[model samples]
Target: MEKARAEAGWLMPKTSGYAACAKLRRRGDYKEGTMDFFDECEIKQSIQRIDELLGSGIFDRKHIGNVLYRSAFIDLLICLRDLMFKCRKFSEPIRFTDDVVVTDEIKHVSDLVKYVRDAVCHPDSDAHYLEPGNIRASLNVLYGKGTLIQTGDFNSVSEHDDDVCFFIGRQRIYLQRHIVRAFNEAKDKLLPLVEAASQKAIAESIAGIIR
Candidate 1:
């Protein structure tokens, strides 16, 4: 995660040329007033949905954590793709190749978010453990080493052997807390980017119509 931020800082430098061009194209058409207010409304609705989910106290921390991280990550990716498409930078794009992975920093974060989601959702799965070390390891794979540090301890067993039962009876409280914090932090980091991308895409689309 840290590595990704650093790389994004380095590679992205500013918004993509594609983004800039798209924004310019949209602004150019503002005189015609072709802006799709409906699309903007939809994006705002989606953002509101996420806000509600994050603010809701109904779900436990782990579940909410998974939802927040997954939703936020996906929202950003879709926003970027939408922006690209609206700007004509990406036309009828097909399957993304593995070699092209590093071109987009959001892709790396998406992968980490998936790994973390899987770890949290299926704690007993043979996949990567949800331990902090493992979480950091997964993030490092995509972003680079030292990008994320797993500061807390994730290994705590119950006194009674049977006490480590499913859902309710384990030491998941701590894990849930950690997951919530991570998701909240990730959401905070990603939301602004997503919003900007969405707005840019909408502006560009309107501009295209006006042109």
Candidate 2:
């Protein structure tokens, strides 16, 4: 119940990247024909999908064993992976941004995103289709810490007493928190940087034409 409480605490209202960018576009905050414009738009679409899946009541404790829940969880993981792993188009821009400091927190969150992406993509190598000793060892490494059911061959997100864990299919990863944080990183940090760069490029192009 404590973990549940913790999970519930972070569900405050969040602005959608899609809506924010749409409003900005309507206001002509930046030019329309920039790569950053489309990149941010696409990234926001992924983030919005992630938010919808997480907040759609699919991960309720009652739905833990449901097939639909499993499918939705897989979808959530894929969305997260695609955002950070596949769609890191803004990383280089952020790296060169003079005003934005890429802090350790950002680094850690990115690392966790990559870890889950790898885990989801290569679960067989990590947990299944390996020798018994190897399998148990890998499971222990993944979801065993601070959990009662650390060394089994289960494949769902399970909670026993206070500990929540994933054996194969899902994750002990606090799915909501990780997904939200990643979404914020993209929406808050990377999106702005990209948008600024796009505006600058657009201004330079316009000035060159005027000159």
Candidate 3:
């Protein structure tokens, strides 16, 4: 398994994603609220944190119960969405190696990420309400008929075995099948951009000193 993972580029990084940015931070070359600061601190750190979370088994329902797992899943979705937003702001068209069209109907992973995050964050706005004992309830988000739906009413959703699907707002999403794969592909594409930005910061610092 380790060999296969290494071959597949699934091995963890020797250093945190912030390693490239650490040089700038150490020299005080970039201050807070700057692009350099955001690149080294927010963008790089977020990718590293996502990597950690994906491997932590927290997203696995067997290891984590209903409420906590859903919370973690929603948080992951939010993080991915934020990362995409930052990437778009910092660098246009985050180039993915493969087609990231998550669903046959949805053209981009960003659409799903935004849709899920928005739905979870503002459920009331969409008239999606959690059940009375939401803290202990199992949830799942289902994509169907060109719309995403959440229902605490299990009978209304497709009958899925708990082992295969992750529960969120009475909907089921397959963790490895969707989230993890998309994250890995995204991280791979984003890392080079982060590294290039870090190098650019270093170059600017050198040029400033020369001037």
User: What C-alpha lDDT do the candidate models reach, one value each?
Assistant: 0.35, 0.49, 0.54
Candidate 2 vs candidate 3: the lDDT winner is 3
- Residue 70 miss distance in model 2 (angstroms): 2.2
Candidate 3 segments whose C-alpha is farther than 4 A from its true place: 1-36, 90-106, 127-138, 141-164, 167-172
Q: Give a tens-digit lDDT track for model 2, residues 45-134.
A: 777788888678766667676777656766776766666643355453212212111244334545555555556566554433233534
- Candidate 1: stretches off by over 4 Å: 1-56, 59-116, 119-124, 127-177
Q: Pick the candidate with the highest TM-score.
A: 3
Cα lDDT of model 3 by residue, 10-48, tens digit? 233355444534655677756654465445456667777
Best of the candidates, lDDT: 3
lDDT of 1 by residue, 1-211 (tens): 3233223221122545345334545676333433333334434454455456546542433453463554443343344333333322212222322221223422432333333444444536434434533442221111111212333553322223211111111112111222233344444444454566556655555555566
Which ten-residue region of model 3 has the weakest summed lDDT? 4-13
Compute the lDDT of residue 81 as modeled in candidate 3: 78
Q: What is the lDDT, from 0 to 100, of the residue 56 in candidate 1?
A: 57
In angstroms, what RMSD does candidate 2 have relative to the true structure?
13.7
The residue-level lDDT of candidate 2 at 52 comes to: 89
